[model samples]
Target: MTTPTAQTASSLRAAGREPPLPFAVTLDDGRELVMLRVLRILPSKRIVGEAETAGSRMLAKLFIAPGSTRHWQRERQGIEALAAAGIPTPALRHAGELHGGGHVLLTDFLADAASLSDHWQAVAGLPASHADALAVLAPAFAMLGRMHAHGLVQDDLHLGNFLVSGGELMVIDGDAVRSLSPGQALQADQAAANFAILAAQLPAGWDEHIAPLIDAWRQDGEGLPTLDTAALRERITHTRDARLKDFLAKTLRDCTLFKAEKTFDRLTIAVRAEADELAEVLADPDAAIAHGSLLKDGGTCTVAKLEHGNRPLVIKRYNLKNTRHALSRAWRPSRAAHSWVEGHRLAFLGIATPAPLAMIEERAGPLRRRAWIINAWCPGEDLATHLAPYVDSGPPPAEAEALRTLFATLYRERISHGDMKATNLLWHDGHVVLIDLDAMQQHRSASSHARAWRRDRARLLRNWPTDSALWRWLDANLPPA
Candidate 1:
């Protein structure tokens, strides 16, 4: 409904025309939308700078169009259905008809305090327990399932539209959401077609997420239309056949079968390949520091002096075989959620982690079939080495200081080092370092809603009970900060 008005002003005789006034832009599609400016900044060399905050300051997204009341009602009802099913779309901020055959709908920007795409790159290479990935990604799949269960169709299935805040993915953009009614198998087919369109837009690797998504859809069934058994099985089969399906198995097998030296060598090759890919994609690829393996040959998965591109970094290839929990998921993190968790922890805690680099699915080959984590390198020394002599005799002053600093660091960020064993800790210069943090507990209040939240909490606590207690005791016994 907002129209452009001319601001008439008498200017110097030869003055040129002024720039166009920023308007509230909204699309017309039988729905009303209002564009709210939450944050505005000048483009640098034509590229928009990323929003560093949770987009508390953001512009409104408007979707407006003219259509019959019945059509609008269907869409509105669909939105309501999704919201009712606990899928957090924007609350209807406002709606109204314009003078012309146009309408507008306004809603809050779906901003994630932590986006999975944003953080997954950082921890992709961390040495995580097998259960860690599942702990993080299962809920995300559940979220997607809830949307589908409620008869809400996600028209756009790209990674960009999905937001991960407080350890959950909330769907936005309702234009493509399809709310189905009973006896509407045909309509459901249409919805599926729309989803197919979106799927075609996704990268090749993302096909693996589909089955879990459909299963989630079924589990979150809220009196909504259901996929037939044959259809469901077909979806599951397709997803199982994706390239990532065997990655976990291969990665675990490699960790067990390969020697430490061989493992490091494989890691190096993967890193080099990743670097080549990054060189093609990154804006300043040269600025990125790539490291292959930190500690190999049965040494602790730790590093000393990351020394990569003058940017302190840590890159860990999680040995998924080491943890008992990994066995449950067949020794692979579900949905790669562990990497995101760890990445967010390092970044939010103001640790010396470089901005996340990239997440490359490292495969040994088509025949051998192996995969592993390859992350940006961090600069530091393994705490095990730093503390070995100390534990043998007396704790070194440097080791104590390192531990103290690490505790303070994680505490400040409210990130718990879930597996804070001596081997996973690191010491560098005068700082305590935390590595292999993909499995750490870093949930927000919102994440507590996941069905698996309580179970995960209990399991996490059970697996690391002594560690948590010891950390608490250590905190109490340590000298005052």
Candidate 2:
């Protein structure tokens, strides 16, 4: 028969083995929680209180539990009562058999996540006479009142404890709820206490904020009292201490009111959107030209020369907004997609581009919604630089031969160089080179076939213009070698 310690070890391994054995575990990134290995410098306000494994949505609570059986029992009893009352609480997914004087519990994951506290913070930052934060506040109060009406006492009530996801609120970590006798006055007292907690943390002039909200909540509530405003205000001031006030103040500064749903797949819709925006910009002759030349040239993008893989490469950075004023507030996946598309085009076209080295996507930087594309450097003089002399010199035989092969290679492959300007072509080491291969498209259909053909024809006209009178001059132009 297996010893109890061996069974426990087997159970822990079955759950999930964390690194560094019996004590240390990884939470996120480099952050680790050392249960028994380290002496306390500062105790974690949040500790891993639960590791419930038997649920569709595995939940682990941090920093909420006081590590007492009483707390655990309170949570378990409250959950059962709330479910009976029809207020949504996480289905007691799984709770450890009471052992070592404590147990852990798990529940279903919440969907459609948005924090009421975050919404309030956004309101605080904006200069406004209009109190718009009530949009979320009224519903929040209604939910709380409904919970209290059902004879559920959430001992630990805070904004974070209530989660709103997918248009539903799921009360979590109920280790502190007290079940009141039906129709008891305890519900009202609990609600008043909870409101006081929220109100104290509210900014100055909160009376104006709460008055309208309470009125709205009262109007919608069933058999609820008309809220006592004066009592509420006094309670807020009396209950909110300096430490709590300081913490709420920090939350206001740190929290974001809204967050976009992030999808982690390699190719995401957000990334595609940015790519489309860039493709449009690159297609614009003026915008492309200006960017090609930097601000002095009035472009929407900037190009710099950089060294990579022992080669001189051109670096392209898109200016999402014309000025910094137009920058986005977060990383734009579209920017990443656009850079990836350009790099892919170059690689497919067999152009001399630096191996795309790395890309830096600034999701939440000053230039939010922006992306950077880096590639191996290609060294050579641009084709336009070499062609400018020949425009007057008349296409030299050697250069003309190289030009024919270059065009032939690209055109035969049914590839369209979106910006086929002469300047983007290069001449290096007696070989024709091409750079700035943005706005590339693969002609996969009949329409694209026609478009690609026309583009190639136009390029020939620009570089080797055959005078209406000079058939041989037209003939002199061949696809670039």
Candidate 3:
């Protein structure tokens, strides 16, 4: 059987012929269930649907692939075991093979529960206070501890596998759940590893809640091994960092959230939208750059403003500075790629930056030439411009606080802006936004990072002449050595 493409499924739905339901199946105990609405399409061509019987409403997972009955059996066993262990799980209704070439498992439908992933997304979008966020996530941490105390391991640790409703936490999709020996519980190391996997999927600022979350979990985790909170925090950070790197690499290569097309040999364009309009610009990037309103023009690079989809955008072209520079960059990745990746990295770290729309590069056989990175126009002045009038006096408390938060984030993340000039930092929407990210990178060694931080501080101080009040204020407020 051919798997259905999203487009085909959409077309079928438009014609009111998709989600074929109202199908009947007989349970192992001879009860009949009528599947009413398709809930979702699972991997391996299986279908999850809402079903009804004479007595109740249910959820039915129909496995259509050949030789999939064994999976249904495993899921049934896992759910039963988990429920027997006093864990919250969906009540299993029936499990059996369909007459024609499939297997079916039925369970009670969760009426008002939402997946943990969805809940997290919703809560993360709100302008909630730190205390509120901690309050929301404390229960989830406690639930994981309960599972570990009972020797239960959810191999598929995705947030979507857990559900929340009426102040209760429950686990779903039990196919990958595992158990230790009858009398055993999760060791400290195993429990920490499990928490790390789950925490890695939380929002970017989850690190702030780690201590409180662990404390809450420990309170409820009776009989569980004692956890080393520091070790668990380190493990969570390490795991999250690795995942971010992999995610950035994949996004750049595949333009996962953007549209990408190779318009010409050795010339590829990636954009957030309006591919046709962007294609015209990429056709001859130099001509487009020349015609756009110039923001900066230097021997090595050019920045310009252009309009796309009725919104202003800024494009920065990275040109060869000189013969030596051209030779050095010939076979290396374009600076455009660097900025694109760094832009995404900052966003993932919950730092503010201009939204990168697209990047275009011209390449020869093993040689990269001119490149351009386009960003949505940010509507605020640079820090230098914003603070020019304050040179004779100190910056206001709010501005000082913003600067402190920005530098503290940089210090904590080990990110160093090679050239930390005030002009490269924008004051936008009550926060600071870093731009020109080609020189931004996270260093590995403490010594190297410190060296970069010293340089950044020196550059920032030099923004004002000697004996300036702003400079003195900044020096006084600089992040501690």
Candidate 4:
């Protein structure tokens, strides 16, 4: 039986979040660092955690990949460079080799600091033009401006890299931070390319509204233009498209975000941090389905809600009726695999969907058979039932706005939900979450998308009587195909 290993960083990362912590590691100088909680892991390669040294708390990075000298040196140099350039970064406290192999680095832990990523998430669901959205984003761009003025560039410029402490923004992730030219403002093109990296991380429709905040990216002494230029926006679009391509690829592999195992006979993958909790379900999904509370038992698929620890999860099984049905689906990717990939795609686009946790497929050499996909359960009521009372009248304010935003985003991204019944849309946490995404697609060609979206739009309208006030309002409000 092939099972997850215990000691290697790879298996430890695949272990569920809250893996046996307070792990001790001896430094080259004979001092020991006891890690109590992990903050992040680059599976099989590195780990960042909160640790103790002689009774004092600090942050530590363990570069566990064998002979990981190149990354270690770059990290050391990057932090040192940020300090030299007068950027506010976590102060480096220690750097040395681990007792046997790999390397370790330590830095001061800011107990009160919060990542900009968390702050952004609080306002991300708001309309793109809302003041709160701009408020959370301005400081990040202003901080990036300061880095540019110092000729510093962070390749992965996202909210998580900036921390809020004592009413100030502090930069981290030194490994991705480097210099174009020290103590000199970046040239026009160089600054655009760097800024685009950050902009690409923002939600869709934000690129059009960032013009007002362009001033924030120009520090008092940067000697840069105040206006948002056309070239910069175009660069942001290009980068964003390329990033989406890269992210979808990560969904199927054993990366930091996922733990995957693939073979011609079988394929399985799960959220890296939750793999351990989901092992029993993965080891024998049929047995799990037999014991679970079945939600559906159809000819094509079956669904059941189950729990691991305190977290509720939904598992879906794609069934084959008989030999003919099995042979037909054998040559194609299972619907379960398709939903897994599409779920990740929706998340990357900032669209709402049940968080995909795992995917499994049974195969005969190159041929596929029964398969399953698991998702974090969404407990919200379906849109059809939620709106039953509002059929004669329009939806409430929150529902109205959320519906607009969801469709507008879909139109902007050229996405079409193949089955547009209201039952597949769930009213969740102040937004409408998309479900049953095996047939969903984001079209590349504008003309082709229009044709498909017409079908989707008309299908949704057919859900209600033509004369219902809700139906009329949606027809007028929704974006044209």
* Full-model lDDT for every candidate: 0.41, 0.49, 0.75, 0.86
Question: Which parts of model 3 are misplaced by more than 4 Å?
Answer: 1-129, 155-176, 181-184, 201-209, 255-264, 267-294, 306-312, 321-326
Best by lDDT: 4
Summarize candidate 1's per-residue lDDT along 1-481 as a digit string, tens digits.
3453221111111122221233322333333222233232211101111111122433232222223344345545656666776777656644444334333344544454555545444433322222443344445555655565544556545444556655556665455566654222224554454344433332222344455445544465454454454554444334433423343333333222111213321322222224444433222222222332335522223222244444444333333354453444443543223553355346533454433443322224321112233345545666555544443344456555455555444443345555545555556545555556555664444343232334433332232234454334454544333
Arranged by TM-score, best first: 4, 3, 2, 1
lDDT value for model 4: 0.86
Candidate 2: stretches off by over 4 Å: 1-55, 61-67, 98-101, 126-131, 184-190, 242-481
Q: How many residue pairs clash in model 2? A: 30
Model 1's TM-score against the true structure = 0.34
Looking at model 4, residue 69 earns an lDDT score of: 88
Model 3 weakest lDDT span, ten residues long: 1-10
lDDT of 3 at 121: 61
Show model 1 residue runs off by greater than 4 Å: 1-21, 24-59, 63-77, 98-102, 110-112, 122-130, 165-169, 182-481
The top-ranked prediction according to TM-score is 4
Candidate closer to the true structure by lDDT (higher is better), 1 or 2: 2
Model 4 C-alpha lDDT per residue in residues 277-378, reported as the tens digit of each score: 999999988887887789999999999988767788899999999999999999998999899999998898899999999999998888999999999999
TM per candidate comes to 0.34, 0.40, 0.73, 0.89
lDDT of 4 at 27: 77
